[model samples]
Target: MAGQTFDLTDDNKILSLRSPKASISGPYKVVFKNIEERWAIVAIDWDGEPRLAIRWFWGNGGNPFSSGNPTWLVIPSSLSNATLNGLPLDFKLYSKLVDFLAGKITGDQIYI
Candidate 1:
């Protein structure tokens, strides 16, 4: 997914995931506590929405996915520190995530 780009002009615009047909739309927040731990709390305003939050832990090497209603998309990886809604996050990883969410890339390409 390298070299691919996405238009995030609208901060409130959301994108959908392919396989499970999950749609992520609205203003969301991402928080990265450390390089090995991170999580995203997303607002669910769509019909049949699966999860409302996303979590990540690098030590386990697990892929991020929706766990429950008002759900959480958990991702396991080490993401650099950056910012989200004035909070810190991994910009690199965040970029990839934007692409993935925009349908410009696949889940496999979400990591650095």
Candidate 2:
């Protein structure tokens, strides 16, 4: 959880962290699946591979930035379409996923 910062810049939007033990060197693409509950997913490139850093279900009581709780769900690039926590990444999830990857949204904020 050390050396982590939220990036909300004009040209870049990501949550980055610099830590030796970090799963991925983030400049991660973040997506919010259930905004009301603050459930989100982050896509990160780790060692030349794509992985999902996700929190399947989180509410106001949960904090995504924390190193503890709501741990990252690392999905291999090949298994991206596979069920995560028994649920498939459907169209709605795909829409939000694309938006986040495209930098159209940052965190829970939607660009106007």
Candidate 3:
């Protein structure tokens, strides 16, 4: 954790993640996946700093700025307001944002 800055950018894609009981090593993994629609999110606490990678499928007849493939982003959760690809944290993502800010993983806390 020496050289790892707290910046939200620079997603290392290293999906290998650490569980509370497991040690984090090699490539890290995710928090959750197959999110609402056209989007998916994964989180990793690199050396105890929580971060998320939001991926979205831009299947819009090949957008000019992109190849129309799913794009991945590592954004800031510390800002007063956060936006994903210029989108507000509203709509279906609102609930997910709440969980992210509160450091709660809803899917992992459920008891069958």
Candidate 4:
């Protein structure tokens, strides 16, 4: 069975993905939780295996995906970007990420 996705709360908060039994494969069930809301879904990683990363992006209605601050995308302050106050989850990009985790893709597919 496929995993589920969790909706992210706290626009600028950092979210971590973790599984105790799974070998961190493609098609993961995500549960977005923080000091606010809770959401879920199924997503995938494109690289070797997905580690804890920050989700940042542009949202609708002139609302930024993150706050007016910089956050790490990869972890331990590896890749940081100044974004809106929220992290926009791009389904298209996520789909590709899933493919990559499934061993069907690689870094050559990441455009942004």
Candidate 5:
């Protein structure tokens, strides 16, 4: 693996992501699907180092910021329905944040 930096930004109706590669090549593609058909591809900022840029839809109109630790991120729409290691996210959180987000429990509630 190589060291890389990734950033997600916004366009008029799509989200833009920029990626760069220092010493890599061959087959390259965006990380997510539905990029061209569902969303418009805008400008790609490659003025700096070896880089990759992509643009995609910004659906339903919601803030994309996160308010938790870096280890955890607010799930994006493109990934909301995606499974992790073959398990749906809802099941993954059921024993933890699911109850909190569903209002079935609170921070003071104990499950153990």
Candidate 6:
């Protein structure tokens, strides 16, 4: 493939959903990965899709789920609290995002 390559750069935390779930979806799966540790799932998106963003987090007393540093809740860099470190994943988002996309909800600039 002449034009096949990998790219990972975005400002919005969007988790593109997939079937069979993934590292950040389902009832039990490692949402966070590190050199030695892996965390379990803490939530699921609407429409039942898998989260694709993998968090490389080493666990000791805390987990990614509890830390709440989600890469799936984008609200625009101009208004986000973690603008510098908001690693938007282009993956799934909170169920609210689904509603927002379907016109079932409304907001300023939140996305998934």
Best by TM-score: 2
Pairwise lDDT winner, candidates 2 and 5:
2
Q: Please write out the lDDT profile of model 3 over residues 2-110, one tens digit for every residue.
A: 0122112333432321222232222233334332343434544433444555544334421112232222354456641354334443445555545544667433332
Tens-digit lDDT track of model 1 for 13-100: 2223222335444323332332324323442223332223443333233235334222335222222122233444467866665555
Error of 1 at 86 (Å): 4.2
Candidate 2 structure lDDT: 0.45
For candidate 6, what is the lDDT? 0.29
Name the TM-score of candidate 3: 0.31
Q: Model 4, residue 44: what's the lDDT? A: 30
> In model 3, what is the error at residue 93, expressed in angstroms?
18
Residue-level lDDT for 25 in candidate 4 = 34
Identify the superior model by TM-score, candidate 2 or candidate 5.
Answer: 2
Q: What total of clashing residue pairs does each candidate reach?
A: 13, 0, 7, 23, 2, 8
Model 3 alpha-carbon drift over 4 Å, by segment: 1-27, 45-49, 60-71, 79-112
lDDT of 3 at 97: 43
What TM-score would every model get versus the actual structure?
A: 0.30, 0.41, 0.31, 0.26, 0.20, 0.19
* Number of colliding residue pairs in model 6: 8
Worst 10 residues of 3 by lDDT: 1-10
Looking at model 1, report the run of 10 residues with the lowest lDDT sum: 1-10
TM-score, candidate 4, is 0.26
lDDT of 5 by residue, 1-112 (tens): 0001122322321322222223222112222324334322221213321222233334432122223211111233333223222333344343443343344654334133
Candidate 2 lDDT over 1-112, as tens digits, reads 2112222232242353322235555535553344454445566645534455654333332344354533455556556545344445556666655564455654343222
* Candidate 5 local distance difference test against the native: 0.27
Clash count in backbone of candidate 4: 23
**Backbone clashes in model 2, listed as residue pairs:** none
lDDT of candidate 6 over 1-112, digit per residue (tens): 0011211121121223222233233322222222234322212332333222233223332322333333322123233223213434234544444344344644332333
TM-score of 5: 0.20
Which segments of candidate 2 are over 4 A away from where they belong? 1-21, 56-71, 82-112
